[model samples]
Every structure is written in structure tokens, then in C-alpha cells.
Target: MAIGPSAVERWLDLSTEELRAQVKQLVAARLPGDHSVWQAIRRHPALVPRIRGVLSGLAASAAGSKDEAMQKVWISKARSALDQEYVAPVKAARKPVVKEEPVPEPEPVIELKEPEPQQKQPHKAIPTMLFQEPS
Candidate 1:
């Protein structure tokens, strides 16, 4: 696309003095949060543009580095640090309470006996008398 007169005017209108002032204001507005970098970024609209600029600069720096291996290492470390900062701590589980059932005791056994005595029978002798008759 051609740089039309209007586009040129728009570009010229962006004052260098104003840009510098905005950048300074951004640096002052920036603050850190306990959870994440974005948490801080989302709170301050003035700092958001500045932070994006810094991140873009970092990416450009990484891309420009002579050693691709070193650039990858730096990127990996940055990602791991960001991940560790926002992760919440895990809580321990509590032990469950168990109810015990009560068992009933067994009843005692009773023994029965007869106390009455049995009567004994007495013996009796029978006598027979026999007489001879004369013819």
C-alpha cells in the first residue's frame, strides 16, 4: 500500500515527546502480584502496553541471539518460572470417623433336679396245711 498523505500525517502526529511520557507513566504504573504477571498487568491499563513492548523486545532479543540453544534454554526457564508461580498448593485429606456396633451378652443356662424319694415294696410268705384221711 502507498503511504498516502493522510497516513503520513497520522504518523507525523505521533509525538515522540508524548511517546516518551507514556512510557515513563507506564513504568511507574507497573506493579507485581502474588499469583501471576498477568494479574498485575490486568490491573494497570497504563502498564499493559509497556509490558507487551518489553515482552516483544525480549522475544526479539532471543531471536537475535547467535546461539539458538541458549535462547531455547532461557525461554524454557521463563515458562517454568511462570508456571510454578501461579500453581496452587494441594491440601491433605482428613481421616473419616468409623462407627462401632455394640454386641449383646449371652444369657446363662439353668440346671433343674427332682428332690422326691421312691417307696420300696415289703415281701409276704404264704403257709399251706395238708391232712391225710383214714379209709
Candidate 2:
């Protein structure tokens, strides 16, 4: 059967590259946005490469139903993304410390208190424990 106008129109509306780009963008956006989907996609051993291939192929294709479906999926993803507010985590502001007022200097009072000289004590020899009797 020949391709219908609606199908042709949809395909004409979005090129294969455009569709692929849409899918890639959607995946990128959703990967970070949705934890579950991202985890699932990441946890899947085979899905990762297959998904990459599919998305890359979708992006590279010039015309196909897959591309059209991806375009719609991208549109839905875009809509959901638009509805949410993208707020970055707020950082704490640093506060400037206030300087304290300087106090007046006090008058110098001289007090003579002589320190006693220290007496030298006799040195004692330390006892050593020799393992080999000091050969």
C-alpha cells in the first residue's frame, strides 16, 4: 500500500535527524529529570547500547514511522519539562563581620619583680635494656 498523506505529512514535518535529535534531547532531559526511568535505562545491561543505537539511528534517519513516534514522544517530554520550574539549588550568602571599636591604651605601670635564678640539677644515667648484651 502507498504511504498516506497523514503519514507523509508527519514524516515531512520532521526529518529523521530532527526526530533523532528530539529523541536524544528528550532522553537527555528525562534522564536527569526522572530518577526511575533513568535508573531503569542505566540498570539495563543490553538496553543502554540498544537505546544509544536506536536514538542515534532515529536521529540519523531521514524519514520513518519510528522518527515520527519519537517526535511525538519528544513533544510530550518537552511539555512535561516546560511545566516544571527549573530551579538550581540555592547557595548560602557569606556575611561580612563587623569590626569592634578600639579601646584607649592604658598608662604603663612599671613593677620590678625579680625572678629567682633556676638551679641546675645533677643528671641521672638512663637504664637501657639491651637485647644482645651490647656485643
Candidate 3:
């Protein structure tokens, strides 16, 4: 069955539990070996329902075809739908993007100064005498 925008919107309106259930059903029906998708659904229990309609539609479409090629095609379509509807959008939303402008380097400045003449200090002569025996 073809999933339209309205169907997706309706799925988006479903409760978290309902969505989770829908995804669980889809996993059981169409993706038994897809542990990663199952793990992701469990991890983001809240997000699973968001793609329920697409996945459900894909699963339904794949249900009629017993051909291995057609089943593979449906699985691929479901995977893409899950990525587009759920994974990619969430990843994009969660990514922290920092936009920074390149700053221009500052030019170095050098200053020239004249050297001052050194001042001579008067030196005191050391006391010649060793301490006289204290009288």
C-alpha cells in the first residue's frame, strides 16, 4: 500500500506506546534479522512510532510478493523509509553544529629605539683591615 503524507501525519500523531507497538510488529513481520534496527527502536522508544506509517506501508507492500527479489526490494525501501523518516532527521537534529568565521591574522609591528648611554657607578674600596681583635 502506498503511504501518503496524511498517513504519515496520522502515524506521527500516535502515542509513544502505539508507535512502539507498530514498529515492533514491523520488525517481527519484515526484519527478523535486523538486530540493529530493533536495537535502535529500543534505544529511542519515543522515536519509533514516528516512522510507523511508512514502515507499515512498506511491510504491507512487501507482504504480497513471495519473490526473494521483491522481498529484498521492500526491505530496502523500508530501511530507506526508516532512515529518512526517523534516523537521518533525528541525527541531523541532535548534531551540534558550530559555524565559525575565519579570523584574519594580525600584522606584527616593530619599534626602533635609540640605546641610552650606560652610567658609571663610583666603586667603594673594600676595608683593608681584618677585624682587629676586639679590644
> How many backbone clashes does every candidate have?
0, 2, 0
Single out the weakest 10-residue window by summed lDDT for candidate 1. 1-10
Query: Runs in model 1 with CA error above 4 Å?
Result: 1-55, 80-85, 97-135
The superposed Cα distance between candidate 3 and the true structure at residue 29, in angstroms, equals 18
* TM-score of every model versus the real structure: 0.26, 0.27, 0.25
Model 2, 1-135: lDDT tens per residue? 122223322332454565454446545454443444433344434434444554546444525664676655654453453334434447989999989899989989999999999999999999987687565
In the order shown, the candidates' Cα RMSDs to the true structure are 28.4, 13.9, 15.4
Task: Give candidate 3's error at residue 113 in angstroms.
Answer: 44
Which stretches in model 3 have alpha-carbon errors above 4 Å? 12-65, 85-135
| Total backbone clashes of candidate 1, pairs 3 or more residues apart or in separate chains | 0
Among the numbered candidates, top TM-score falls to 2
Q: Evaluate model 3: give its TM-score.
A: 0.25
CA-lDDT, candidates in order? 0.44, 0.49, 0.53
Give a tens-digit lDDT track for model 3, residues 1-135. Answer: 222233333544667666645554554456533344544553454555555454556556566566646655645655654554333334445768799999998988978889899999989889887777888
Model 2 clash pairs? 16-61, 20-59
Score residue 39 of candidate 1 by CA lDDT: 40
